[model samples]
Target: MRIVVAHNRYREAQPSGENTIVDAEMAQLTAAGVEVLPFIRSSDEIPTMPTTAKALLPISPIYAPRAQQELSRLLTEHRPDVLHLHNPYPLLSPWVVRTAHRHGVPVVQTVHNYRQVCSSGLYFRDGMICQDCRGRALGVPAIVHRCYRGSRAQSALMATTLAVHRGTWKSVDRFIALTTAVADHLRDYGIPDERIVVKPNAVPDPGPPAPLGDGFLFMGRLTPEKGLDLLLEAWRRHPVGALGPLRVAGDGELRPMVEAAAAERPDVSYLGQLDRAGVRAAIEASAVVLATSTWHDVLPTVIIEALASGRPVLGTALGGIPYLVGAGTPREPAGTGPASVASAVRGDGAATLPVGVVAGEAGWVVSPDPAALAAALPVARTGAAALAPAARARYERTFHPDVVTKQLIDIYADAARTAPRH
Candidate 1:
C-alpha cells in the first residue's frame, strides 16, 4: 500500500518522542515493502523564514487555507492510499484533514498530545497538572491564563485553530491513541469512542538483559514538566547512602539546575545531551529508570526503552504511566508480573500477564511529590530484578518493530478502506 506520513517536527533543541516514533514507523513501513512517502516540516526551519512569515505563524486558523492547498497538491501528485498525520500544530493546522478528504485519501491522526483539548498541548501549568479547560471551550480559560508559553496571543491562536477546525472532525477516519486511558479521555472531550484506537508506542528489541548497573538513570528533556526538581528532591531525601548514583541523560531548560544539583550531590551525575546510542547504552547500564513527570503524559518512549532493555522503571502515577504500568490489579505489586516477564524475553515472546500490565506494567507509580518518590525509591531498588523479566517480555510482544509495524499497517489499511471517497 502507498502511504503518506506527514509530520511537523518539534524543534530539535527539545526533541519530541512523536518525532522519533514517526521516523521509526516510516522506516518500519519501508522495510516491510510498503511504498512510504514522508512529508516533513521542522520547527527549526521556521525561524529562517522572512519576518512576515514568522509574524503570521500564530494565524494557522487563517493560513490553513494555503496549507490545505499545498497538501492537496501533494496528495494529487502522490495519490497515497492513506495520509498518516502525527503533529500538525502552529503551521500545518487541522485543515490538512480537509485536504486529505479533498484528495480522496483516508486521514489517520495520532493524538500525540492534548493540543486539541488544551491550548498548551500539555495539561500542565505552574508545575501542576492543569485540566481547567477540559470539556470547556478551548479559548475560554486557556487564553485567560496565557497557557501556551505564557503568551496570551499564542494561546488564543492555538485555541482558535482548534475551535475553527472542530468541524474538520469529519475529515479524519481514525485517531490512534497511545493508550486506552487517553482514548477514554478523548471520548470525554467528544471524540467518538469508536473512532479512536489504542496503539501504544513500541521500541526495537535491545537484545538480552545486560548486567544491571548500580546507579539510577533518568532520560528525557530536563524540563519542569518532567519533574526533574522532584527527582532531585527525592535524591536529597534518599536514605543517605542507601541509593546508588543518579545519572541524568538529555538536555533542556533545566540543565543548569540538573548540573548544579549533580555538583551538590556527590551521587548525581549529569550526562548532558546524549545521542540515541548513548541513551541506549545508558538504559542498558542503569539498574532502574526514573520517569518523574508532573503532567499527564501519553506513552513516553523512555519508559518503553527501559522495558526493552530489561530495566525496571519508577514512574509517577499520573497520566498514561499508570496505564502503561499495567491496569490496576491488587494481585501484583506495582512494577511486577507479566509485562516485566514479557519484556525480558530474547525475542518475540508474549507477556504472561494482562495486556494492560505488560505494556503498562514494569514500573512503580508514586504520587507526583518528591516525598512520594523518596518513599518509593527503596521499593524500586528492591523490585528491579523481580520486574526485569516481565518488563522484557512486554517489550518483545508489543514494542518489537516487527509486531508494531503490522498493527500500524492494519490501521492504515482499515482507514483506507473505510474512509469516505471524495
Candidate 2:
C-alpha cells in the first residue's frame, strides 16, 4: 500500500521523539516493500522576517497555504492511499487537513503533545502544569505570561490558531493518541471519543541486556520541565557514599546550569550531546535511566529505549508512565487485595515492595520529591542488575521493530480502506 507521511519538525536543535517515531515507521514500511513517501517541513524554513511581517503572517497563516499547495500537487501526482500526519502546528496548520479532505485522502493525525489546546504545547508554565486553557475556550493567559516566543503577539497567534480551528473537528478522520491518558486529554478538549485511537510509540529491540556499570544516567533535553533542578537537589540530599555518579546526555537552555552543577559536584558528569547510537550505548551501559520530569510527559521514547536496553527506569509517577511500565509485569493474584503490614515492611519476606511496584510489577516509582528520590536511589542502584531480564523480555515482545511496524501498517491500511472515495 502507498502512504504519505507529513511532519513539520520542531525548531529546537534536539530531535524529538515524534520525529524518531515517524522515521522508524517509514523505515519499517520501506523495509517491508511498501511505497512510503515523506512530505517534510522544518521550522527553520520559516524566514526570520521583521516583527510586523511575522506578526501578520499568522493571519493568512502563510505556512499553511504553502504546505497545502505543495501537498496538493504531490497528492494529485502520486494519489497515495493514506496521508499520515505527525505535527502540523505552527508551520503547517489545519490547512493540510483541509487539503487532504479536498483531495479525498484519509487524514490520520498523531497527537504528540498538548499543542492542539495549549499555546506552549507543554501544558506547562512557570515550571508547573498549567491547564487554564484545558476544557475552556482558547485562553491567552499563556500569552499574558509570555509562554510562546516570550511575546504577547506571537503567543496570541498560537492561541488564535487553536481558537479558530477549534471547530474544525471534522477535517481529521482519526486521531492517534500515544497513550490513553493523552486520548482522555484530547476528549476533554472536545475531540470525539470514537475518532481517537491509542498507539504507544515503540523502539527497536536492543538485543539482550548488557553488563551495566555503577553510574546512573540522565537522557533528554536539559529543560525546566525535565526536572533537572529536582534531580540535582535529590543528588545533594543523598550522602556522598550512597550516590553514584550521574552522566547527563542531551543539550538545551539549561546547559549552563548542568555545566555548573557538574563542575561543583564531582559526581555529576555532563556528556553534552549524543546521537541515537550514542544514546543507545549510554542506556546499555548505565545502571538506571532517570526520567525526573516535573511536567506531565506523554510516553517518552527514552523510557522505551532504556527498557529495551534492559535498563530500569526511575521516573516520576505522572501521566502515562505508570501505564507504560505496567506492561512489563505479570498480573497480581485476583484476590491479593490491599497490602498488609507484613507486605509493607521490606524485611518481611514479601515478594515485592508496594512502594516501588508499578502495575504490580515493573520498576520503581518515587514521589516527585528529593527525599523520596534520595531514598529510592539505593534501591535503583541495587536492583538495576536483577531487573535486566524482565526488562529485555518486555522490549522484545512489545517494542521490537517487527512487532510495532505491523501494528502501524495495519492502522494505515485501515485508514486507507475507509477513506472517502472521490
Clashes of 2: 0
Count of steric clashes across candidates, in order: 26, 0
**lDDT of candidate model 2 versus the reference:** 0.74
| lDDT (10s digit) by residue, model 1, range 75-155 | 888789998988886568777887788778888998888877788888898888888887665567889899877888877
Candidate 2 stretches greater than 4 Å from native: 47-57, 60-63, 327-360, 419-422
- CA displacement after TM-score superposition, residue 223 of candidate 1 (Å): 1.4
Output the number of the lDDT-best candidate. Answer: 1
Off by over 4 Å in 1: 327-361
Candidate 2 C-alpha lDDT tens digits along 1-422: 88898888776586587778788878877987889989987777567755754564566432466667889999999998888888886666777877877888888888888877888888889978898877657676877887877889878887877777776544577888888889988888777877787877777666767787666899888889888998888788776646678889889899999999889888888987898778877886688888888777888888888888888787777676665565222222345422211123333254344442332134666556665566567767877777766667766776678887787788887777775653
Question: Candidate 1: lDDT of 2?
Answer: 93
Supply the TM-score for candidate 2.
Answer: 0.89
